[model samples]
Target chain A: MKHSHKKWVTLVFALSIVLMLGACKKKVAPPPPPPPPPPAAPTASLTANPSTIQKGQSTTLTWETQNATDVSIDGIGSVQPNGSQSVSPADSTTYHLVAKGAGGNQEATARVTVTQPPPPPPPQPTASEEDLFNQNVKDIYFDYDKYDVRADQQAALQADAAFLKQHPNTKVTIEGHCDERGSTEYNLALGDNRANAVKNALVQDGIAADSIKTISYGKEKPFCTEHNEQCWQQNRRAHFVYQK
Target chain B: MKRLLSVVISVFVFSVILCAQQDWIRTGTGLGVEKVRVAVPDFKLNNATPQNTALQKTFDDTLFYDLEHAGIFDMVSKSFMPTQVPGMPSDVNLAQWSSPPPSAAMLAFGNLGATGNNLAVQGWLYDLKNTANPQVLGKQYTDAATPEGARSIAHKFADEIIFRLGGGISGIAETKIVFVSSRSGHKEIWQMDYDGANQHQLTHLGSYALSPRISPDGSRVAFSGMTKNGWEILMYSQDLGRLVHFPHFGGTNLSPAWSPDGTHLAFSSSRTGDPEIYVTDSDGTGLKRLTSFAGPDVAPVWNPKTGGQIAWAERSQVTHLPQICIMGADGTNQQHVTDEGFAVSPSWSPNGQFLAFSWMRRFGPGEPGAQDIYVMDITTHTWAQLTHGEGRNDFPSWSPDSRHLVFQSSRSGQEEIWTMLADGTQQQQLTTSGSNYEPNWSWK
Candidate 1:
C-alpha cells in the first residue's frame, strides 16, 4: 500500500506543476493590441488674410483643426472646429488657436502685423481775423489811479502796435477799464485818459489814427470781481476788441 | 392898581403891533426855524356813503403824511389829540388843541362828502392859539370821488398851509421825481410823485436811459439815451407822450441839465475827444462847447435861481480826481469849489446859496472812508456834510421848496432812492423794488 501512495503523490505534484505553467502562459499572452494607437494627436492651423493693415482697417482670421472636439482662439472664446472671423484691432496682435481632444491639446499661432497709414497733411493757414488778433494782440495794464503807460507794459504796447501796423486794414476798439476804488465820474475820466494814451502810443508807432477807437468802461464791466490786489490789477487794463 | 392895568394893556397892544409888523411866524428860508406843532384830525364823513367814508380815510391819511413830510411841522400824534375831532372852524375847540397834551399851534381839519360820483372837501387851517383870529386858510375842492381825487385835495390843502407857514416856499408835494430804474430789465427813465406814488415809466427806449432832467415847465424830459448811434441826449415831450427829435451830438453825451428858463440845456459831451461841457438851445440848435480840458468835465448843473452859472465835476490835472467846479454860463470865471478828495454830482440849491454834492473825504484803496452828501455855501465856500458815513450817498436833488432833498443811497444793501430834509434829517427810502439811481427833482 505504501508503494502505491508514493506513486500517486508524484502524479499529483506533476499535475500541480502543469497547472502553474499554464497560469504563466496565460499571463504572457499578447498585450491587447497597444490601446488602439491613441486616436492621432489633434492638429490645428490659424492664418490671417491681409495680415498687414493700416489703422482703422479690418482683417480676416481663418483657422482649421482635425481630431479636435473643442477649438478656440485666444481672444475669440469657444468656436467651431474650423471657421473664419473678421477683426479690426486698434493695434498689432497675434492669434493663437487651441484644439483640445481626447488624444491631446495642440496650439498654433498666427501674427497679424498692422502697419500704420501716414499722418494727415498740415492744416490750412486761413485763421479768422479775430482769432489772429486775439492770439497776437495783448492787453496792457496800469497802476492805481494812473493813466500813463507803465514801464512794464512798454513791450506789450509795442507788440500791439506792431501787430496793428502789420494789419493796417484791421480796426480796433480799445476799451479802458478801472478798478472799483474811486468815484464813478473820476474813474470814467481816468479810463478815458488811459484809452487815449494807448491810442496815442499806437499812432506814434506808425499805426493809422483812424483805425483805432476808444471807450471807457469806468468800473462798469469788470474782468475780475474780487476785492484783492491781484483781481484789481487784472481789472485795471486797456483791452482791445477787434472791429469789423 | 388902575394905573398898572393901563400900562399892562398898552404893553400888550404894542407887542401885538410889533408881532404883526415883523411877521413873526414867517421864517424866511425854512432853515433854523422853530417847527410849528400842527394837528391833523380824521376828516368827518358828512354824507356817510361808502364812497364818502372811503374818500374820507384817503383824504385824512394823505393830509397827515403830506404835512409830516413837509419838514417844517411837528406833527401831533392822534393819541394826544382831543377825542372830539374838529371838522371845521365852527367845531374847533381852540383851548383843547392848544393845551398841554397836543400843544398844537395850528389845526388842519376838513370834512368830505360824496354826491353821486363826485367828492367835495372843505378844509381849513386855524391858529389854535389865536382864538380871536383863528382862521388862517380855508379851501374847497370838488372832484370825482376816487382815491386819487381825495389825495389831490389833501395835497392842495397841505400846500396852502405850507405856503402860509413855511416862508412862502411852495410845497413839493406836487413835484415829481424822475430817475433811472432797472426794474423793467433795462435802465429806463421813470417818474414818480414826490412821495413815491404813481410810479410810471416815462420812456420805453428799450436801451439805457440815465440822468433825466425835467424842464421847468414840466413839458419835456431830457436824458442820456443809449441810441443806435451812441450815447445821445434824447428828449421826451410830456405833452406829446412820445420821444421828440434831438440832434445827436457825436460821441458819448450824458447828464443833460436844463436852464432855469427852460431855454437851454447843458450837457457833457466827448465830441472833441475829451468829455467837456457843452451848451445848446432847447431845440438842439446853437450848439456851443463850453469847456475844453485835458481831463473829463462831466455832470453839469445850472444854478436854478440865476441860470447864469454852471457847476460840474472836473478832474484835477495833478491828482486825476474829480473836483466840483463852477463857471459862468458862457464858460468864463472858472473856479474850483472842492480842493481835495473825489467830489462829483453837484446840485445847485434853488436859492442860489448852496451847492449839494457827493464827496469821498478820504478816497483811496485800503482807506476807511465812504461817499457822503455835502452842502456848501456858494458865497462863503463853507461846507457841511449832510449824509453821515451811511453807505454810499450820491446824486442829491433839491426839492422845489429848498427844504428837502432827494438822493440815491446804498444804505439799504441796494441802491435806492431816498429823501431827507436839507439838514439830513428824516431820511426815508422812496424806492425798494429795484436798483434806482440818478434821481432828479422836477422844477416847478
Candidate 2:
C-alpha cells in the first residue's frame, strides 16, 4: 500500500511540471508590440527634368517625399508631398526641398542651369539691339533691392557684352524691375540702378557706354506672377530690349 | 415811376455791396481746441435769373465745402439748419443760429447773381456772441459769369473768411490737386479742385503717365510718361496748350520736382549708369548730379522757403533701407534724416520747418509693415505719425499755404487720393473711382 501511494505522488509531481512548461511556452511574452515603430524619419528627393536649357526655355522640377506632414522648397513655397513645378531661372540655380515629419526632418537638393544656345540666322540690317538681345542674351537677375552684379552673373554679362560687340550697331535698353516689395518710388529708383548695373557690366566688358539705355518699370511689370521667392527672383531682373 | 423804382433798388444793392466791412475777430488758436461752430446756409439768388440761380447753387456748395475742410470749424450740417436761410446780414437771427442741435457760434450768409457775362457775389460772416458788432466779415466779388468764375468768386470769399478766422494762416480754398488717374483705361494726369470738383484730364498722350508736378507759377506740368522711345520726362505747358520740349536724355527719367524758384528741375535719372538725383535747368539742360552714393537716390523735393536745400530718398548702405536725406542745392552738406525702416517721398513743408514722408516701420516680406504718413520737425528730427494700421498711405504733397496735405492712400480697396489738414485732421477722400495716386497740390 505504501509503494502504491508513493507512485501516485511521483506521477502527480511529473504532471504538474509538464503543465507549467506548456503554459510558459504558449505565453512567449508577446514580444512588446515591436516598440511602436519609432515614428519614422521623413525623406525627401527632388529632380529637375531637362536641367539644362537655352536662355528662353524652362525646366520642370518633380519631387517625392515619404512620411512627411509638410513639404516646402527653398525658393518655392509650401507644396504637396509628391508634386512637380515648372521654373524658368535666368541663371544657374540650386533649389532646396525640406520635409517635416513627426519623427524628424529631411532635405534634398536639385539644380537647373541656363545654357546659351547657338547664334541666330544672319542678322538683318533692320534688326535692333533689342532684337539681337531677344535672339541671343537672357535677362540678368538681381537680389531684393540690389543692383550689384553678383559673381555668378558675371559670365552671362560677359557673354552679353561679347554679343553686343559682335553687333556693333546694336543699341540696347536695359529695363530694370523690382520684386514688388518696396515703395513704388523707391522701386523705380532701384530698378534704375539695376539697369545701370547691367550697363556698367556691359561697358566693363568692352561694350560701348553710349550704346546702352536704361528704363525702370519698377514693380509694375513682372515675368512670373506667383507670390513666392522663386517667382519674385525672376521679376527682379534687367531685361534687354534693342532699339528699333 | 417804374424806372425810378428800379433805379432805387439798384442803388440799394450797390450800397450794400460797397459798404460791407471785413473786420476779423479771433476766438482761440490752440491746437486741438474746440472747433468754431459755424453754419453755412445756401446763398440766395439775386434777381432769380436762371443763370444767377445756377451760379448761386455752385457758389454756395463750393463755399460750404471749403469752410468745412478748414479743420478749425465744426460745420453745421444743412439738414440741421432752420427752415429760414439768411441770404443777407439783415436776414440773419443771431439767437436762432446759436441755438442747439447745430449750436453754431458763427454764420456765413450771402447773395449772389449772374448777369450777361458777369457774376457778382456779396458774402458776410457774423459772430453770434457779439450782438452789437456781429459782422465778423463782409466781402464782395465780381468776375465773369462763367461757371469757373462763379467757383472762383466763392473760393476767394471763403479764403477771406478763413484767413480772418483761422489764426492768421492763409486758406487753401483755391488750391488744386494734380494726380494720376487710370479711369480713362490708361493712366493720365488729371487736375481737380481741392474739394474734388472740376476733375479734368490734362494729358492725352494715350499711354501711362505718372507724377504730375505743376510749376510754382502754374505754367506747366512736368511728368514721366511712356513714350514710343520709352519712359521720358515730358512737360505739358498749360500756357501753350501743348507739350513743350523737356530733354529726354536717355535712360529712365522720373519724378521731376520743381525748385521753389521754378528755375531748376530736380529728377531721378540713370543716364550715368546708376540712378542719381540730377538737377537741371527747368527745361532739362545743364545737368548736374546731386547724389553720388552707390545705391540709387531719388524723389527730390526742394525746400520751397529756403530754396537752398533738397530732400530726397537715399538707399542706406548700412541697413539697406531707403532713408530720407537732405542736401544743399549745390549737392553739399549731405545729412541723413531718418533712422530706421523704409522711408521715401520726402515733401518739405512750405515753411521749410517740417518734412512729411511715408515710412514703413516693419518693411519686409512674409512680415509686412504698415506704410503711414509722418511729419518731422526738421529742427528737432522729432516726428508725429499721422496714420495707423490701415492700408498703405503715401505720397504726401503740401498745399501752397502749408495748412493741408494731399496724398495717396489704399484704404478704400484701390489706391485713391486723400486730403487732410496739416495737423492731420479733416481727412477727406478726393477720388472714388479707379486708382488715383501721387497727388501733387498746385502752388496756387
Worst 10 residues of 2 chain B by lDDT: B22-31
- Listed for each candidate, the true contacts retained, as a fraction, are 0.26, 0.62
The best candidate in terms of lDDT? 1
Give a tens-digit lDDT track for model 2, residues B1-444.
323422342343344334444211111112224568889989888789777777888888888888988777889999988888888887988898898766889889988877778898889999988999999888888999977898998889888888877756678888888999999988899999998989998998887788789999998999988887767889999888789887877767778999999999999876666678899999788998888888878889999988999999999997788999999999999999996888998899886767899999677765567888887767667676667757889999988766688999988888899998766766889999798989999887
Q: Candidate 2 lDDT (Cα, whole model)?
A: 0.83
Interface C-alpha RMSD, model 2: 1.4
Q: Place model 1 in a CAPRI quality band.
A: incorrect
lDDT of 1 by residue, A34-101 (tens): 55566778999998889888888989999899999999998889989999999888889998889999
Query: How do the residues B1-444 of candidate 1 rate in per-residue lDDT, one tens digit apiece?
Result: 323422342343345335643211111123234689999989888878776778888888888989999987999999998888977777888899999899999998878898877889898889987888999998899988899998888888889998888767678778899998989988899999899988999899886788899999999999987676656899999999899999987766778999999999999887766789999999999999988877778889999989999999998785677889999999999989888888899998887767899999787767776899987767757676778989989999988777788999999988899998877788999999888988999996
Interface RMSD of 1: 2.3
List TM-score (chain A only) for every prediction: 0.50, 0.46
Candidate 1 retains true contacts at a fraction of 0.26
